[model samples]
Target: MATHHKADQPTLRSLTKRQWIRIASVVAVVGLVVAGGAATRSIYSHANAAPTAEPTAYSISDAHAASRGNARDALEGEPTYVNVTINGKTRTVLGTNFTDVKSVLDAGDITLESGDTVEPSLKTKVDESTTITISRAGAKMETEESKIPFNTVKKETSSLPKGTEKVETEGQEGILEKTNLVERSGDKIISSNTFASWVKKAPVEKVILVGTAEQQPQTTTDTSNNSSSSNSNANNNAQSASNNVGTTAPVGEMQQWAHDYLLANGGTEADFTATVYIISHESGWSVSATNPGSGAYGLPQALPGSKMASHGADWATNYQTQLKWFWDYCKSRYGSVQGAYSFWQANHWY
Candidate 1:
């Protein structure tokens, strides 16, 4: 009994190892629960904390400028995803390493054709918000038709009375066909120019006759008895010319006019008769008569009609003008109206 250890030391040593382990485990569990609760409280506190006041708002113009700057910054930044529209369909382009719109199009496997156009030029830098558009060719060659104006030709002649004017041929407009290279968008024409041109129908030139005939001296009727008989006798002598002349004076205004005109101009009654016959067969004395098949015109029915213009520009409408032309042609070609009539009787044309 005298050799015993200290009491405290013995007490500790008496406790079992299992018992000590159990106590330590209990303490550890309690500590974990308490720590978990404290962590949750800390999180709740931070969530409820008051936020700091926001910075003052910028002006509208300043805000716009800032937005623009941001856009510019984004465009110059790293590779981004962009949108590309060819025709009307849209698709996203993965601009992985693209720097500009052109590069973006290349990445999208898109191509441009002749006269094709793009919005936001190919040289512009691309960004996530950038959209590239491709439009089809806008220019094409087309045929166009329009009117061509006719020309007018004037000639001086003695067929009409002095100081008179007459239109021998009416003017006609012609067709002008052209090849036009036109630039258009949809239905709108932006620009155009004629590349080639041709006349579909040649224009008919208008011929005008201006008279140059000298005025005849007017005879004053002498109410005096002595001159009245003289004047009557003189008038009879003028048209009849000679009792020996074989042809009779024609009746009617136009016919009598022809008769007097021929005789006064050094023509025979036979010449007047030949003229009436040829003119009657050819045109019935109508100044505007036209031959559809041969393109002949006027009283003389001259082919191409323009030949009548040599005698008078009024050849198309004036009977006197056409008659004069006919007389001139007869004299030049057949020696006289009688000769033309002789030829016409056999050939049926003169």
Candidate 2:
């Protein structure tokens, strides 16, 4: 009977609906307070946080001082590539932060020579990527005088044997020079060339005695005896000396043929040395001198070789024919041996 009374006093199922609403309201209030506190704490934390870092400053200038500092920093900090022109060639290299323009070139293995010039000096610093150019040195020139071989002249006199002559004086020589040699520093023969007829002189011709004449008294008897004796021995002696004189080295048939050819072809002793000089240089008294490089043949080294035949069909063996060709060539080209020799000196060919 007693247990039944206590159950009736505190039974939840028996509690009123208004009482349940009050409990639910209290629980909602507590939850809102806790949530507001959490939101406030998050806002405070965000406001008090530290800020991020900023970027470094960079500058470029033409001035040496600022550019130097900037260039140094750039090189030390990071690798930047730059372009440089050296020795007429373009080169690219990585510029260090502390690297000046000169040092950069050095690192690139660009060395300056005596005549070489660079746009930027060693003290110049580059703040940014840059291009440096180097100009190579040009050729050097030199002048010199050189003695050259000239023509040989021959002369005949009554006091000497037939076909004999002597070189009165040595042939004249001249000088030639070349200019502008291209080479590196301390190099020789950079460029070379011959100067034009700087000076010219007439070459002296050779002379000699060919024969002698005998003078006789005006008496009839003496004159008759002298004339008879002269014919008898002179004829035989002349015949014997003919073969010998023709083959003689300096005063041989060649010299005689040259003399006859020149006199007949409007040439004089004054121009003799000039003519001989050219022929000697070309053929050296050899009828068979031929140019293997250009196919020039004969004493004159005629390009076609057949051109000499125009003087005479016997140009191959007849000195007169060769001399004729030479005379014509001289008149048409140089007017004389001296003129021709002058041209040869400058050009090495005429």
- The candidate that achieves the highest TM-score relative to the unseen native structure: 1
lDDT string, candidate 2, 126-219, tens digits: 7444567666666333434444344333343333444555444554543322222235356555433221112122223233224433443455
Model 2 off-target regions past 4 Å?
1-250
Work out the TM-score per prediction: 0.30, 0.29
TM-score, candidate 1, is: 0.30
lDDT of 1 by residue, 126-158 (tens): 776678877665556687766644445455555
Against the reference, the lDDT scores of all candidates come to: 0.58, 0.48
Query: For model 1, which pairs clash?
Result: none
